[model samples]
Target: MAKIVDYGAFADRLKAAPNRWDVLREFHEEWGYAVRPGSDRWDRWTEDEHETYVRALSGEPRDEDGLEGVDLALPIPAALDEWWELPFNSFTHDSQHYETNPVYPPTVRPDPSGYGVAGPLQDDSDLVAPDADRRVCVFMAENQYCNEWGYLAAEAHDPDPRVLVSVDDDRWALQARSVSEFFLQLTVQRLPRTLGWSAEIYDGEEIIDGDEDDLRARITERMPELGFEPWAELQQDTIVYGGPDVLAFVADGELGGIAFAGRTPRAVLDLAERLGVKLTEEDLTEPGEY
Candidate 1:
């Protein structure tokens, strides 16, 4: 979500400006948005009222007025190909720290205990080695951890920095604080603009002469029209034809096929007899069974 700025800070920035209009201008300069106060009988204004008008000020390119007409007040973040990195964090006195001290040292000194033989040697020394088994959850965790503990390690490590690549994620996180922000932004930007951009071309349409349903009806409604007996087999989105002394016609939208039935052993001979029509090749291949 876009970080919420303090309204008091916003108001303070505009305090020097003369009137509400100046405040609106300064507000836009601070955060790319406008706010308008609500109205009851349609005569009211508030600090946030400017948003109502300025929000409609579009940034879309216009040829007649050129850049002057472009609405720079629109809150849409400029599209960035790369992700913006939020600061890891700030330093504080009460910040959590993980540390360790030796309870007892070796009886015989290997390196620094410096004793021949003893019951147990107590040494006050801190272990500053970083843990190697911490699994990173988010992309930012890697950089944040590196910023904190890059120096201490058993094996030398070079943490490769990463960034969020998706534009959709960046866009929504700017508009609102929800998963539905993308949908809302798209709706607000697209739905109202569809007045000039709509799919009116396909409003009224006609089907081709060999419409799947029509073709099938021609075979079954009058089998003698094609010199055969009537039959129909309906599958999911598919219509098949079969009967005595008939060429089975399978029709599915643009895809149609005719195969030989009862009297014909080969489909080629049947098609040869009933020539002058489109035929689709039969697909005998089965899926995944192979």
Candidate 2:
């Protein structure tokens, strides 16, 4: 049987959360973890094993796999500090060869930390903010498929600063008003499509065979209370919706996929029930998480 999370209980917990970190922790505990292939990582490494591996990868002495101590060239946001500490988050600088990250940029690594992390956006950053030169960038996370996401140095001390996304390292804009909102937006939008067990309503699996435009239109008609917001300004028609307990999204125009997720198996399945979409618990054969 698919595990179902109690919507009422989860909603209550979210409202009662003391702060944003608590909300993130709530998802961490519920979302669980997925160990990508070849990522046994910290537990498998002896004290010096990871150190030696980093040194070998960089061709110089280094101590950390990710951005533990590397100078981001600006003050680190408190929310980012907390994000790095989350034990359950799968996003991190584990094996540079295995995972996606900020170091993907070609020009930024002249000062190679060797862990495949990018240095501060120096020199060419005049393209983004010519007047605010001191307000550079400190990229926290990125992936090969998605544009890079980070924060401005000007808002570094603000605990939860606004998020910035770039088409390239230099073409930047506000992705979210605050870090907490950004994480919520990212989680709600991403879970439905990427989670291994999720059903693709329009494209990919073609499980629903619904027209992309119609699927989006009907969803909007049914859940008028839940409004869609831009997932990224550059990714047209890719929008996201979040509720106290449920989250849903529509992807880029070509795929036009619709996905829904909640705290547990039952929670997401209820989306089918509410939307009158046809799906069964048993249909969730693949495991959850990335």
Candidate 3:
């Protein structure tokens, strides 16, 4: 089930407005849509708009979350709000080993107190709201979490909403089919360990070092079977193989990480293991705070 918003109607109203900015301002002030700063595109907005939207959707932060002078216009589920309070390094299960990536952490504005949850929305020229207006990215994982990519999106315009996870910009995987389902998984089931900082499970040590050519050959041979093709240069140390479904990260003649659109975590892990990468207990455990 998709949660649809009347984006067409909203667009229509914006088109009818004598002053486009005024319409956007009204949308922000009244209908809770964040007006993008420095851009006339109604779909685009500042990071503050994202924070505002999250705050408005989730209400005030919890007392223990260290948020003050904040009011809840609409009450969001306590569990979702708790997610916002979690420290940037809180993704790892072990509190003692909660490490933050130096590059990504400084960029993230802590929710409830700083910039709410996510960074600015990425460019979406296709639709005002992607996924048929059913979802909006609320948070992005730190770079250390699967190479500083991926997003935590929430269902919009629905009473019973769910959280979605997308490693790449294109496709999404269901994180929680409903809000209650999300809470249950976070608190009890703990199946989707990749949520928040739990993705550290996949951050294993560099096990095998092959020649760069060998690594490229292996990827050229194996990735297509996995539904990906060589895409572009990632960094001086890395090569990227991209497809509609997954992104393969290769570095130093080793497969560093794989971001999947439709693949299961277990399947990806199995593939990694087959490639000679193994997850040690330490890798699966929380890391020390950086």
Cα RMSDs, all models: 31.1, 7.2, 17.7
lDDT (tens digit, per residue) of candidate 1 on 5-51: 33223323433434333332332233222222331121112334334
lDDT per residue as tens, model 3, 1-290: 02222222443443455642343233222212222344222122357655655664466553343233233332343434334343321222222222222121112212344543433334452423564332243433333443222123222334445444333443334454444333322321121122211222122353333343454566557653311122111221333333322234544323344322112334334444544445432333231222
Candidate 2 off by > 4 Å: 1-18, 32-73, 92-99, 102-130, 134-136, 168-170, 189-196, 204-207, 224-229, 233-237, 242-246, 262-269, 280-285
Listed in order, each prediction's TM-score against the native is 0.15, 0.60, 0.29
Least well predicted 10-residue stretch by lDDT in candidate 3 = 227-236
| Candidate 2 lDDT trough over 10 residues, lowest sum | 102-111
RMSD of 3: 17.7
Q: Which rank order by TM-score, best down to worst?
A: 2, 3, 1
Tell me which of candidates 2 and 3 scores higher on lDDT: 2
lDDT of each: 0.23, 0.51, 0.33
Better of 2 and 3 by TM-score: 2
Tell me the spans in candidate 3 whose CA falls farther than 4 Å from its real position. 1-119, 122-210, 223-290
Would you list the clashing residue pairs of candidate 3? Answer: 36-45, 59-72, 91-197, 97-287, 98-289, 99-289, 111-116, 143-148
| Clashing pairs in model 1, backbone N/Cα/C closer than 3 A | 34-51, 35-48, 35-49, 35-50, 35-51, 36-48, 36-49, 36-50, 36-51, 37-49
lDDT for each residue of candidate 2 in 1-290, tens digit (9 for 90 to 100): 24544433443555566665666555544555444565543332356755665564566755454444334344556666565555544454233322334331111222244332434445555434655533334343455534556666656667888776654454555677677656655654544334424555555457464455666676666553232236653344465444434555666643456776554556557676676677687665354434
Model 2 TM: 0.60
* Candidate with maximal TM-score: 2
